[model samples]
Target chain A: MSEASKSARPDGSNRPAVQLRSAVALLGSFPALAGVDLDVHHNDVALLQGPNGAGKTTLLRLCAGLIGPSSGTAMVLGQDVGSANGRRRVRRSVGLMGHSTALYDDLTVEQNVQFWAAASKAESETVVPALDRTGLAGRLQTVKVSALSAGQRRRTALAVLLCRRPSLWLLDEPHAGLDKDGRELVNGLVLEAKDAGATILIASHDLDWATSVATRRIDVVGGRVVEGTVVEDAVVKGTVVKDADA
Target chain B: MLSDARLIAAKDLRIEASSRVLLTQVLPFGLMVLLLFGFGISPDRQVLGEVPRRSVLEQVSPGLFWITVLFAALLGLGRSFSIEAADGNLDGLRLGGLDPAGIFLGKAAAVIVQLAVLEVIVGVGAILLFGVSLANVGLLAVTIVGATVAIGCAGTLYATLAAGQRVRETLVPLLVLPVLAPVLLGATQATEAALFGPVSDGWPWAGLLGAFALLYIAIGIVAFGSFLEES
Candidate 1:
């Protein structure tokens, strides 16, 4: 972790990593997040499970500071994500892996990872280790991303996230398009990140695999967080309440 | 911010180097436009009111050159944002924590570099095909720099606005062309003054170009983040 992120924590260390109260977000006229009240504590591996268009991705995006809430409050990493300036301030400390891998087709796997790491102001030395950890070392690192398979692209994105070493990770369908080994790698990485004191929010449909690593499961239905369950052997305890509107 | 801008610019340039889309496609398209203009305008015909018996093509070369550049720049701008739009790379940049102003400047810088190269190639093509001689190289150089910056800033801003649209390829030119009229006029008039004589006449137009560039750059830096989010 960087000194800047370490210093970004609020005066008290007891603050929740992600706190949303009646938060709502819109995509055009449609409300993707009608009203969501969720709290995820530090070092928690929380899984968000939902059907398509149930606002799982929207909730993740809001936490990542990619989308500001239309109403109510969203605090992530001690920063208010409802305001533009707040979103900008919190963005560096958070990492997101969305539906797209976000890799440049023309750039080599190494170049893509390096560009993102530099953008995040990460240490240059982390780049190679990230590549090796994601199994994109040597000749694969030099190959253009356009030539890579879907699984390779996901691995490259994972390498990018690893290099940043962000405090908060928002992953949407992280296991998609990955082989069995890749899936295990992702689960291992999530566990490693949790052990390293990073908070994670994963939105995935692969429940069997996701549940294995998740400490808590939150169901998102109709743009609201509906039900919560504590996974077996959970470390951190938190509450997930349904929104007032739901 | 400057360091981030440099990183983005270098990344973009590296992508261009690997893709070679500008070299293989857009550059040839620009040269082709100049060639078409050359064929369209009659070489033997003299301007009715000119003193030195200049041909119609030479008299109109400056305007034709700027027009070609404007058309070609649309393609460049489209390519710039299209790359970002593809696979949600723009979102990646935003989430990466790079300052929005830095992204704007970096993208504008990349566009300027590419446009500068296109301008040089098309400028030489215009000179050779239209039989125009350079008289005031300094004024022409200043005009090119200012005009290119103006185009780069405005083009990058508008391109961001149109990015991620289903009709982005068709929408960009519609949004950008009308905004670039002043650049076309300023650059053409300045070039005419540079090529035809009376070098003092071009400085004011060049100043206009510089002002336009500065205004658009400031606006782009302030507004690019919002536009990026919306797109």
Candidate 2:
């Protein structure tokens, strides 16, 4: 798994974990990611902050190979993410945690994690320790996800992420719906994964919470990454992008 | 690839077992459809004893059986994707590294399992309630397998096409039913020939059904990735 994560270019140098060159993606004729250019290296913890509809989620989805760039190139782990073979290979080594927990309402927590773990080609035995790491050890294997609280549900999703051990973690709002303890678990997990050499890209509105763990931070607004700070402008609903030089 | 397909199919089947939605709801609805057709066709036989009830039922049983199976199978197809859409489990599956072709095959296979069980119960009920008998049971088997495969593959493919859309519920039937007209015609005619004798046209109908099934399976394998990404 570690060897697979070190995806090398033709010249044998390891490629940037994610690289987007003037990439454009459309959602219903509207550009979601409009001419975006960015790069993140291996083990880099890059944080993305923006107002709603600023293309944060779209960028993450693009990196996850869930959406293709309408124009330009979006590469992840040396693969052109727009291609089918590239997307399939990228999916094998990347994990994306989005708004949804993605857990089955009827399946038990253990079963949910086990299913993902196996799908990610991890050993089934990793499920137990993953659950333990996420502080869901008390929940019985028979307990359904629908029966769990919001925090517990988040923890279960975290457990699946831990077990999969993806090379790249694309997380959108990791702290959403989590309590203080749950947030701390997320913080520790991110740092831990980075220490183990996994690249991380996180998109979140809560700048203060994410700032502490982020190695690099960028602001996005109006579907493009701006060299700016996010200001609370009531007119734009908290999406005022003020240039850094301003 | 087959292993991935088997894993996905197993997971889907486990979820179905836990919910019991197909068994408790869909199966009963199919039987009710059969019963309703029985009443609708044989209305007050004492008043109108012009045509024999047994002969009329026998004549209509092939169409009724296929219709009931199609309607009941719709329930499973809709629910199959609805469960995934509930919390974005579909995204999880996509990111889980399973090949898109494998996912399609696995989902279609699970639907086949469900429809096969539904067909057995409904077929038996049709035989008894409609007083229909089989002449060439072998041809009947061929028709069932080919038709069920056709429906399952087409259903899974079309269901994913509308997986996350607002009008997915209405859109699925519209997309799937029209495409499935050939399967219905072939299966119904094949069953008719199988039941009444000669087995002449039944073979050709079964062949057509098999061809449609293979075509769908191939299309699903090659096309699911693009369709899934769009959805």
Candidate 3:
């Protein structure tokens, strides 16, 4: 295992990593997330499968403490996502890779990764390894993000996420712009993170790949989680076991 | 919090260095405005009942210089947030767990530096073109520092408020200029006293500018997180 996989593991306790009960989030006057109920345990690689405007991104943002729930309760890493101080505390432990890469175009790949790591208060040593892991160590590291291709930008964003090593990883469309090799790199990183005891919630249209890596599958529809759609993945046996409620 | 502020400030400055938008675009724009004003109010032309167009231009040069700086600061402020709006960098900053107050201070600090540079270049242009002489260099420096800090804090605060909006480019001026009216007036007055005469009269205006800067700084520190969350 690489040193990047040596981050602090989840505690042995059974406390859920994410718990939401009728959590509602609004985008302006419209309810982007109507009401969601979910519970994700530590080390679970959960995939949030949803159609366009189905609120998958909103749910991820809520868990990341970027937005507060308008109604109901949301708890991530033992902090309420609705309170300012709680959200701040939750943010310290969550890593979110949204649709946007969140990169500074004028900054070199190395500078962007280092800035994020430093901002997250992660150790400075983690930066070089993250770049290497994301295949951004050589000449790519010196290139400004604006000069890079779409796949390269995605890799740079991934390097940033790796450097932080947050307890919960929220990735939206993680494989959108990647090539075949790049897609495999993402899957491998997801597995490595899961094995290191990090809980992941990914929203991806690439169903086959996401399902292959996810331990549990969730379907979100109409701004809410489809009841009883949660299923346990038997990737080892290449089958899915539906819940009794389904 | 201070450490985070330093980090964010350094990051912003690095972005500016690489892009050079402020230097190549905004600085030149300010100088052009000064030159245009100089041309419009030719020193040879007389007006205001034989007050001598030269004297008239010199008297109003302080106001013209501050106005030019304000306009340039608007462009600087817009550029500052436009980078964050791009690629959703503001969201990334929020999730980085750095103190919101620190981010506000860092951004405001970067704007202050940029605006200060704009003031220096435009100040020299105004002095040479408008034929104005500085009577009190100390008071002028104090006024520039206070006014620049005030504009930076207020501009940054408003910029974040308008960030991520589709109309951010248009909305920032609408939101900030009205709020910064007092700054425009106070800076112009203090600058006038600094360049022409009566240095004692400028101190009160400079004091007001300083007070406004401190007020906005406190507001930004306390309220920045909320604004950031909304954006």
TM-score of each: 0.94, 0.89, 0.93
User: A1-94 in candidate 3: lDDT tens per residue?
Assistant: 2122222334545557888999999999889899899888777778899899999999999999988999999999889988989898999899
Runs in model 3 deviating more than 4 A are A1-12, A227-246, B46-54
Number of clashing pairs per prediction, in order: 0, 0, 0
Considering the two chains of model 1, state its CAPRI-style docking category: high
For model 3, state the Cα shift of residue B35 in Å. 1.7
Question: Residue pairs in steric clash, candidate 3?
Answer: none
**Cα displacement (Å) at residue B213, model 3:** 1.8
TM-score winner between 1 and 2, please give it.
1
TM-score of chain B of each: 0.98, 0.94, 0.95
Q: Residue B188 error for model 2, in Å?
A: 1.0
- lDDT per residue (tens digit) for residues A164-211 in model 1: 998998889999999887887888788778767888899999987787
DockQ, cand. 3: 0.89
lDDT of 1: 0.89
In model 2, what lDDT does residue B91 have? 87
Per-prediction RMSD in angstroms?
A: 6.0, 7.0, 5.3
Query: Which runs of model 2 end up more than 4 angstroms from their true locations?
Result: A1-15, A228-246, B43-53
As a TM-score, model 1 comes out at 0.94
